[model samples]
Target chain A: MDSTPAQVPEGEDLERRAAELHDAMLVVDGLQYSHWNRGVLEELRAGGLAAVHVTIAYHELARETLSRIGEWNRRYQVHADLIRPVREISDIRRARDEGRVGIFYGFQNCSPIEDDIDLVEIFRQLGVFVMQLTYNNQSLLGTGCYEEVDSGITRFGRQVIAEMNRVGMLVDMSHSAERSTLEAIELSRRPIVISHANPASFHPARRNKSDAVLRALAESGGLLGFSAYPFHLRGGSDCTLADYCDMIARTADLMGIEHIGIGTDLCQQQPAEVLTWMRNGRWARELDYGEGSAEQPDWPTQPDWFRNAADFPQLTRGLLAHGFSEDDIARIMGGNWYRILEDGTQPRSA
Target chain B: MDSTPAQVPEGEDLERRAAELHDAMLVVDGLQYSHWNRGVLEELRAGGLAAVHVTIAYHELARETLSRIGEWNRRYQVHADLIRPVREISDIRRARDEGRVGIFYGFQNCSPIEDDIDLVEIFRQLGVFVMQLTYNNQSLLGTGCYEEVDSGITRFGRQVIAEMNRVGMLVDMSHSAERSTLEAIELSRRPIVISHANPASFHPARRNKSDAVLRALAESGGLLGFSAYPFHLRGGSDCTLADYCDMIARTADLMGIEHIGIGTDLCQQQPAEVLTWMRNGRWARELDYGEGSAEQPDWPTQPDWFRNAADFPQLTRGLLAHGFSEDDIARIMGGNWYRILEDGTQPRSA
Candidate 1:
């Protein structure tokens, strides 16, 4: 598919303002499930992203998830000039100052902890900062977004939330069922996040948050990162940059500006098999397509305006054109997430 | 301290009757933390115990706990003639028929699960049937008996209870604080159990259940397995078999016959170092003599009449002499526990 032209105001002065603002701000992508390499790291650096929450586990078990972290550790060592590991909010600033992307770790599912509650601290110490209670099916913690019966959080799920809160891990419920998501917002002592999901009123995808969830999230000081994943967008692959920013504006109106940011859900440079792995893991023997159907058992094509990390500035320019103030644009781009990361990643006092 | 004599009727005919009843009944000890060997198994067999719930994890993490389960698996294979792993209630019957002790696994704390909720099922599949929400300090699940302020069962604790209920694992709150224990009993969909604890009204130990907890336990269809641990007994090492039986009778009066059984909490033949391991694990750097002070930083002396598994028949004699009916004696001997085991260990139907 042909890449869409950047949909900004047709003037060099406006472009310079957007470019300068994107360059000066601490751009933090709330989530991305990309196949990371030097190319992806270079694109993130090129996009002026100071930090990005990278999905390290979908349905991987503890051992496998640890191996993925080990892989990222090696990447940080090898690509020291392009990327750094994010253990705290200071690391994001350090990455920005050093002209490198801070790669923060997250799990799209609770699979990595597998049933052990102590691994929360273990993973937190290893630089995993965010974990979703469920992915797209029923986990020990709670029901996923796709499950017909939503039993909310299980007894074990409640324990996990408290432990995560105590150990400074941000509880993400992006792919959890509605009841589970709402329950998590109510149950977590610390602020939670939907790291990468749109509003259901805008897109109506199963992965999107409801109006009630968004409001509760704001009340609990949680953040909701609007998704750019085509499946979660209002117009799928054809979603215009203008319409995407308008959706963000609408979400900001509902959730307040501080609770909104960009997660993008970018899955760049991944093979179709990786989707199968993400959707099925070791839990299912047969293929489970998750958000895709049997005939479309692969990742949907990303919208052209935000196809890769390098296209991030397009969002900044689009937001500017869509009439968001520079301050609001900066916060929506990363400032809000930066504040949340600062608050969410500290050990709770006894 | 000299061992106390068995406080049962002296007549040889009465002794024979107690022995026959002990041998004939399905004698299930709700909890035991013995240093397992062929000798221990022999003692259990000599006592005519058909099954025993064994503590597998105190404060061990997931990897260490899994190693413990592996150790048990090897033991089950090597000592196949003496012991069998109990995954289901039918296994208890099978062990009895085969003249072997059914070893059911339990955790004295939720450490094996650590932070992940998924491990509840994984551990259940590996033969863990009972799990205490806390040991003697605050865990992710709840406040332990040693913690001053009980915050009740945590949000995570509630989730864990539901997962445990769904997967057929019994929620044991024996070492949890009062509020946490009560909350767990109330929160659990399936009846919870105090797998090894005594009534606080009888002993007044920090580890014993309050009268309110006991009443609630009975009302909620839960079971209380009386602990014979010195710290939980009314008079410590000086607690007479008669006093113990009287305590049991009192508890039965409060909780009804169906809710009373014997856990024993027998730590037979374990070295003082083993107690250190149980009390501290990797959590404490300094010596933590749990239930013991600096002056008594060791395993307390066991009451003579209940020193080891082979002494179990003395309890049957004691209860019989204490004026319990043959039917009540039979129920207290193991029948009550057997019924709870049947009810507590099975996947909950949705």
Candidate 2:
């Protein structure tokens, strides 16, 4: 249930051009919170996702969060041919040379730090480069989108912001509240990010941010990796490539193209039951329907036009049809994210 | 410096009656997060605080929270004459009759729950009847006042709210953001409480609730325990008793007398350095001035009129001088908290 652009450049020529451009670009997905395995890793490697921010925590505690990191360490050992852990920006290039998907560790919540602020530095040492202060709920550092009121960053949050900045961890406010997101942008000495959320205007989900947040994000030198998760898309799984690209084009008008990238939020090869661990996270005795209703509570069907990592070419083709310059297409594809990753994760000198 | 109420109802006659009334009433302070020792418990007993919600965790992990509860159990055994643990709402009266301050366990943040939802019921069983979804910052359960954006109740937050509701663990949102607080009110089947915060109209701290939140809290049958924290007062430590009462009276007009009570956030006998644990916790590597400025970044001076638990009589005197009837004054002073605590902490039949 997808449509081509209103005027796609005449047939196979466009498809061939899109494939070449995608292959040539440094394609990066800022978030991948999947129940990933060898098969999923293989898909990413085959699809030319040169770099990815891999989620290792949802409602996990500091020790549990560390265990997830340990699990990834196991994955790196077993799937060395397909994936490599990217500890530094230069490592992505090294990974690409080796023809592996370069993955960086991230956390959806600040559970990894728990109450100890020193854990911020310890986590960075463990290779967790990007962390959202809150997932969908309120985190220790700040408010999430789902709390009743958007309490701004806590006093402790101010210290975390400075510590993260000093320690070289990029702050991601993808699931945070409006005031918290804006305050985070202003608070961080470094650029922060809304790694996987569309504009709220694009879809009325509270998970999506607002125009004001996007503009502030851009002004603060932050990134807004347009989400491809069905919940963030206008029509869910029925959303067309054209409609999704239209959203990106419109958002680019508000936030410059240079601030935009892709974050699919794709939970590939994941069971619907895995969603329980995600949405409920041992936090509920009863079942929780997060984005889906009780009648259809499961993983949403990814849009046919952009189903998985392999569908990157369709995105490139759609962008070209939207009249984006080849350079802008490259930037949106991965160039912008790469530049920011370099600046955002650079450790401050003593 | 303490100023007398603007104009008294004549002199010793009023003071004598207020003291007699205070002596007879069930004075409750909904929050007391302090570095308490046996001496502090003695102070509470001497002050005639019949019931008090004593904080056990700020940023402690689940096991650590249990240890604090264990420590309280020790206090109950050693200083049984001065303090008793209040597990049931009926236990408050027992404590009053016994001439001891009935102490209930509370957590400022949901750290005690960690990632386990089952901990809600376990904590309730352990006699933690009250828990704030968040402290001054974002928590796993919901948003805090200090975040930049108020993401609404999260998917996980929805579950936590429902579970807390089902388990009879009262949700306290004293430090939550506006939207999160409102959503928690709607989400919980039972009424939640903002256990310690002044109305935003009283002071402009991010820690204060707005009129909309206060109204919603009242309409939802929740309680508003007016905070005596200097930062929330009109003039910090210089706040006059009359000004504090005026804020309460104006709030009463809006919220009605039945919904309001006193939550003197009195960290009695806590040394200035303890503010570090209360404000910064271990989360910040750098010094964090939560409410205080860098120049005066320690414990704020409590207003002289209400310096400790010793000042409960002064609050009753102040309320009486504000033209409230004695019955209404009782509700504002402690009866509302009592009534709400009864309804809020009752576990449902299996």
Candidate 3:
């Protein structure tokens, strides 16, 4: 259920304007880990989303990645008012125009890439512009941010970055190790991204970035997608939209406007079954066979970010109230990322 | 070791220019989680950082957070050429002007608040402008992104948000949960922030925020900080600077200009001991008793983003290559954040 009308302090007029603007915007969320279901898609529509980057590489997803994509495709047809599977920039553009959300098929880890460079292109052709070389655990690429022994990016990671660049796929370093992130940034011919992580300025856990790292990313022309995980913020679980906007402003101050964008890594509609599996540690475990040892502890499971995706408008209203300009709001909402897709996803000229 | 310069591609000139610009830049990384040792502080100066947000609430920083602050103060005095502990916004400004890397006192978790509302003011008075309500685990305020069970903001969290507002401290939600983040946004009267984290456009892990989340943040007139962790990005560990910038640009396109800033969350100066503690789950354990199991199993352990803090120029060069405007670049490089700090840290009218 939506927040109570009594709880919604925004007047009906503000709500109306917010709804109008949200409806007109071409919104594209980079990552949505939620399980696909009618309720989830409905929430997407209710939130006025234009497109979403869906992940199909978690352990549970590993077995049925392709089948899930097909299922979503069928679902898209059934829910034409709400969703459209995105396969390219054109698909995203078309979806934005038609008021249908474009579904971009992306993998959270290479469990599906399964050590094949060719699969990288295959996935890219299927609309996986962004790909993380590793997941929570270390893999053929390198150690993840949560790992204890971080040796840096591995040889496989080098190959993956190269392949990703060759295929016009965007390489994400959100959960990667610090060494791997730095190495990837310096090694990739194309600009890479830390699509979803927090600044080390505020928090120093494995979950955030350092000022030096942000500078390195900015210098490399990579984008730092600011995240809104509550624990990472100063206010903990009690943070508000002003908190999220404050983060955006701080990131913009550090990375500059042209390089800033929004990547709210939401898990909408994914059922408890999947979330439960995530708690069990299969998702990160699959990334590294060695990490499955008895000594290695599983990820500390946690509740999913909002229960679902229907609450996007609240996010919009929050940003508007935080003092973001209409144009800047549009860019952060989707335009800056649209440019990235246009430039980064295109095949390189020989 | 740095990448082989002998393998210098045709873009060597660009690299040189980036390095020069980065060196000349009044670069101020928002936070550092390194142990307050000479080596780390030296590294900060080596990177030509104008200021660094030194942490006083990491794992090993237990009960001794005040000592750590005092240590930074002493170090700043001793390393006068290299560092100066900052206690106010103006102090940071002075550090930037003086060519000495400013040392801003910060806390990764509000455990330092130790269940006291007035401590918020005490810390703020001590130059703790940036504070994360929780670390990797939950606290009295709310849940951390890594907690197995995330309860939205507790009553204490609500009070924390309000107190932060009353005391003129910037609220950071980088490690928080969605419910808490949303709640903080709604509860706070001032512009709150998620200082660092990736855009949800790519990674769907708990650590990242959704596009809707970032949009909501921008809508609320707050800022979304882009981060540097790689796993949070699309292609886990293989991300590059271009991809990073793309994420930022995406947010900027959607959220508008003023709602963006850099909270780089740099942990460059952290000692190996601290890294070990952070990686060993001590940080989160310290925050929440009886909790602090390993991070989600799917999440990788600690992965370093870089060897140290000297590589900031690489990020700047990459951003310049990506076609970011100079004005926009300046904003991302820290101009916009200064404005936000001014707005967020203003003294509340009693």
Candidate 4:
């Protein structure tokens, strides 16, 4: 629980050097669930984000999820200059070249598919790149991180994974339990992802992945996105930027640097009511305080060093100060995510 | 138009014989858009309907269409005794054995899929057994009957047809323009269907199929369900039972008897506003009277001989008096639809 920032090179030249490096790298955020608007898109552009995987569904059924997608479609139409929808890896490059942010859709839960397996392809065709098998509780597909018993993937879940593999939708296990996450990594033919979770050994949060799951995920060529959410950090809002970078470096040592990237679970500008909806969704009659106490069931305060998309450059500075090379910094920023996405988002050969 | 009833043996025994024949046959109505409720389900059972392909979408996008399916799912749960959802052909036999009506969902327009071709399989997995290519106007897939210029199936429509064929959803072209209908039949690898339409030669209505389309449909092993809609009838609401039977007999001659079956197109007990929604849906600012005049924009009055499901037996007797054998009557009633359903509702081998 060390909350102090480690000493780093304090010259203005070093700070300017970090900013220039951040501008040069193709930075990508693996997951973000922000209150999207033109302002948010502009902020992402300011942060030099080439692409971001945005969560559009947590517990929404097919109808509600499609409505959310329609809303995003409208946003893409209106903010054509600031952001564009991402379907292929080339779209990310185009975003970088155009100096805009590419918004890639992801689902934090499998609720959007409901009871039908074919909806996986339907969502993929609609440009959903990543889909988690479960959220924070039990789903039809598998047990979630908050569930007491960790039952592996269900029979229908296996069928869904196969269909997802066939359609080239990347399987995510961000909020899945240990057993379920391990099983999904083994079962998916293509490389899976933990789009927005840190190593449990780093902070011991229920939403974090265990070392065993991380080893399997890395061995299978999957990606682990280091989360910046306060609850998943070591010292909540008091955790220092230097400490966060150190954790990322440690994780890179455990699971190779190729499998490590940033997925700052940023819930920027979302109202507190949305968090309640995310946790309860229509399943619970009572408020389920997921990661927070009943007395304070709200989004935890983000550390000042990483409060929003605009603060992503601070992490690049912290990593550079931690003695990581410019090449390693560039890979951690977005290159690794781009490589995994290209490998995972194409349909399997017949 | 001939309005006279054909001569028949006048006796209680002949009346008893027709009733016995109607009850013995596997009566299937290929399409109906009734205000579904327990009362309507009871009437369907009373008519000895083993299965009825129910219209669930017209100009609805994906979200609205999924909501409609959710509503039907609720109906199936609440009225389990009177009706059950149909998926496979065996569901029809199960319905007949359980003495409940099998409700097979279909779409009168391809709107449920919106712009995504993968939704074809998604809707099929949701138990939508049939999906028409268009309604009374142009769609993403093809041109409808009411369009002045018949632009046949588009490029995306071809992909949708292949997906629908692979997923076992019957491609319906009942309300499509002639050229589009012909193109759909030609492009579909599996047998396509015109789930509800009469011959244009029989009535010359804009919504009716042409002789060339019917010939192609039959030659491709597709079924054309004869419509009982007054607008498509020769004499509107005054059409006689004998004339309707003769139209069926003539159609059976044109397309083989194996390709002709009843589709009724019955719109029983629906409020007039629903008709406006069907014709307008979100696309129009002004109401579009599809078949009826603007002054009388309402559901057309059903003919006296076929006012509701209860009047099905009258048509059975009329067919018998038209010199059709008992075996032919049985085939016309439901056997033909069943055979085609079995062929068109199973997924094609990879």
Candidate 5:
């Protein structure tokens, strides 16, 4: 619960390298939806994070999503010393160079596009770099993982993927159904991402990807940002950093070292109501437990080793201990995500 | 194909009584979602329909549904001579006496309520008589017929049903999945209606009810409005009047005549886009060929015997020809619907 970074464990000699590696890396979390404030902003900087693909909307429509973007614009204005917008992929490098945490916009659901295909470009122009095909239910474009059937990419989904490719909006399928996710990988012209999910081989969860989907994603040149959210981990909140890093290593062996990275799925300092909004939206008149069970129907506790943004450095230390090479560690930390963004988030035709 | 009523096959005298029977009875069609205009209204009047539960929204949100209601309000003003809004159950009698087709507002989907439980009362106050829990896909309330699985009645669904019961909104489960529909029948304190569907025994379509559901519905004192929509018929557009009536007769034997009526899910004089809007709302970015397949995705042809609202007399003739007693024919025509609405659509507390 402490905001301050805990000191590196045991040997003072080993601490030097962990601190140096954390400082050297451009730590980019592929997804986080924390309740943004000046306090949360400070934590990302403390964690040595260069860029983060933060969720701007879950089930919001175009106009509502625009309002959320405006709110973030206000945050950028107020916290100029700590944060800047990643309008272009280069802005991330600029933030890393200047020591500000770069904020890149992403949608957890396709609601921001509504039914208008034109909004894909409009949002890309507005600096939204990543968009998932569906959140956790069937959407206009494709079926979400929570749905009964996995009807693959809809006709509109096919067109939207093309538009997202043209406009440089990276497709994210973190919460989409299996067939839809597989089809999205095959369908997208550019590399897609499962922005924040662990492998089902790591933890057989509804939200996790199959070995087949992960392999297809890697073959299609996609990135898989390993989720640190406990429910997707082997032992839920009790999952140790070693177990977490081990899952990443196994996933790397399957997906190739170049395709793996840490997303964490951190939702720092969010109220219970925000959790309700994300789970239920306007779709349910009743409570939808979502990833949580009825008895455990609130946000699950994040693992102690990875509680908030400030705990991100622990991931670097844990990965090093798990025997990944320095270059692989750098890529798994942020280098791979940065490489993907350089090509993926640029207007190809425009 | 003709607008004028054709002679009841091989019996001129039977045709005269069919007209008289249609005229003498209330002749309420439980559901109709035609693209309303002066022409469509004229057809309802020609059919001698005393009241019609007309769909005002398929997948419209609260504000959108309110706007739809506003559009209907405009129709009441423009077509006052031919039609009037049915605010109360007794409004049906008033319209019957006045020789105008009473238009009762209904929603084919629960989208109008959005996530708010209070909108159930708001819509009821606006003269919205019926609201289906789901259209053809999973919703916040319940699973639709098209979903691969059915997790019956969400927490919100239970609350919405109770709110509906308190506020006098008739719960209609015409397009919900089997478990959701069955759960709704058992859960609802008041009897629910399947406003537009046939027995699975007749057609065995996805949208049709099973004998188990139909029997439970009848046992619960509910009603089943036989849909004349061709996809729900045994022989599609070629189904004869005798075949249609025989299906009804078999259903009547199973369900009792008092629990049956006509819905004739008519979509008259509308462009193909309306069908797209109904089948695939904003939820589907692609064209969802609901009820119709990819090859035969457009609106299926209405049977020749029941092509339009003006063809209501043909149903009476067919039922009479099927040897239903005059009392049973009266019940099947409109009496049953009127009886149910008398108690089902009044706010119990109010």
Candidate 6:
């Protein structure tokens, strides 16, 4: 699908207003972890994002997640106009209020929580608002998506679910197993989220959830985040913003309105090692998948899903071209996730 | 009340053997959270202790805890027979085997566990075996002795209690409040301990447990360590080792040999700020006691009941003088606590 339309009468004015409004709006990325540095953040600011989740949980990523947080703080000082670390939903709003791209730090694995459930609140206080129960293999909490046989959530996992609810942290099951995902959905007191996943309409792999899970999530007031990973696209190489729109459109068609939003899974500055890390269970523990070549990066190359943050407008523009009302487009861009964050992460005491 | 012998049978061989056995037994202090440094550790070794619980949890003591751990490693290079950080029961055995002073790091509060229950396992792995739920004020887990109204263990605290059980951490409630202590005892699947506490036999302060709490702790298959801090000693300044012996004898009488032991809350080698910090909650907050002066190091001077580690044997001599049997003295000195550590802190997987 040609996502880019040729010679529109309102093109210049629409593009200018889109840039201006995007700059002004409180844009939050549901999930995206990249090997972010000054340049990558500048790209995000250029894309009109108010906040992005800086992920550091996979084993292949740098060992110290804390130091990564410190690194971001230090780097942002040199580029204060472009970026800042966001600890709360209000921080995101303040970033938008100040025209700075806010960063919400998160880990894709519950590993950083280690074994104690209480550390969840400490990390939350320290600005971590999102955590996946497992990273592609079994943890003390639950099984990951890549495990050969998923055992679902453990007894401790249920306790973690309850504690997370009490502490007001958003539970992301993007890389979790189907059994665990279903268990989490039932077990969580608050709405449980698949922070990034594709519908089987777009990809039938285990990495993608069925339309049923998406609908179930919506029923429970959770949001399904559409991943930007190329494998999730229906037409392998022939993919673009329009194809992504089609996937979102199909999800909207199947699950109805308010059930979907963009996860981007964008790796504008992510290194190849992060993909390799995700493929293995721990740093190097391979699941039953056949031995991969050491030379190859863990994940395949990005297929033409909008190149970087700079191409975010193309996504908004592409959705508009698909006959989606502007209100629906706004929800898809970020409003849906904003609602989930506000509702799901608000502390019970608060 | 004179702890020194009322009658000295001149030059008895049994008295000489008693002195020799006391000196030779590789006596371990089990616990002492003095603001430690090289000087303090050297004094511990000089005092002939095989090991001591180097506390890292009390707000004032830990600044040098990590450094002390490093120094112990360095001292192992020079005086390997004198010091080693103990992480497991096996380490205690190894320290005995190697004739090295085994340092089991302890926390006077779960503040280091911060809010994450996952940190329980992480710190357990790091050699922190004993953890107090609250110091003397409010923490995420529960209220301390100083909190005016004590709320029992929160739901998050329940999960933490379970995780601590699962991870083999000894839950200490020495400075914890009444309700929180009772709740912790009820919630922990494994035997929970008040690593150091006195009964109202000594002081009528919240710092000492009532007979009911002590009896319940003992009946639940847990031990209550009798603390020797003079503020809790009966008759205050007029008290002697015989008085201390009488208190331990009575506690032993009440709790049985298996459920009673001694934990000298020795503050030797700790500078004044350590006490001030303890009294004031680590310099971050002022004294919880309303009238305490903030600027001055307002903690009362170390009582004359005990001065240093060398004073341990006088208690044994005093206990024998008080007509307690040798077996009872052994249990009181360290054997009962040794059994408790073996029973309570072993990993479930083990």
Q: In order, what lDDT does every prediction score?
A: 0.86, 0.83, 0.66, 0.86, 0.87, 0.70
Q: Who wins the TM-score comparison?
A: 4
Worst 10 residues of 3 chain B by lDDT: B296-305
Tens-digit lDDT track of model 6 for A109-160: 8887666665666566557778889877788889988788889899999998
The numbered model that scores best in DockQ is 4
lDDT of 6 by residue, B216-299 (tens): 888888887777766666665456776777777787777777787777777766666666666666545534442234553344
Off by more than 4 A, model 6? A7-17, A60-63, A281-299, A303-305, B1-350
Provide the lowest-lDDT 10-residue window in model 6 chain A: A288-297
Q: In model 4, which regions exceed 4 Å deviation?
A: A1-10, B1-203, B206-350
Cα lDDT for residue A25, candidate 2: 86
TM-score of each: 0.53, 0.51, 0.45, 0.58, 0.51, 0.53
**How does model 4 score by TM-score?**
0.58
Model 4 collision count: 0
User: Positional deviation of A227 in candidate 1, in angstroms?
Assistant: 36
Candidate 3 chain A vs. true chain A: TM-score? 0.84
1 or 4, which is superior by DockQ? 4
Question: Number of the top candidate by lDDT?
Answer: 5
Task: List interface RMSDs for the candidates, in order.
Answer: 10.7, 11.9, 24.5, 7.8, 13.1, 12.4
Summarize candidate 3's per-residue lDDT along A187-295 as a digit string, tens digits.
8888777776778776565668888888888888888766555445555445455556677778778887667665666665445455445434454444332322344
TM-score of chain B of each: 0.96, 0.96, 0.84, 0.96, 0.96, 0.87
Error of 1 at B234 (Å): 2.1
Better of 4 and 5 by DockQ: 4
Q: What is the interface RMSD of candidate 3, in Å?
A: 24.5
Two-way lDDT contest, 5 vs 6, winner: 5
lDDT of 4 by residue, B133-212 (tens): 88889888899988999999999889889888877889999889989999999999988888888999889999898899
Q: Please give the DockQ score of every candidate, comma-separated.
A: 0.02, 0.01, 0.01, 0.07, 0.01, 0.02
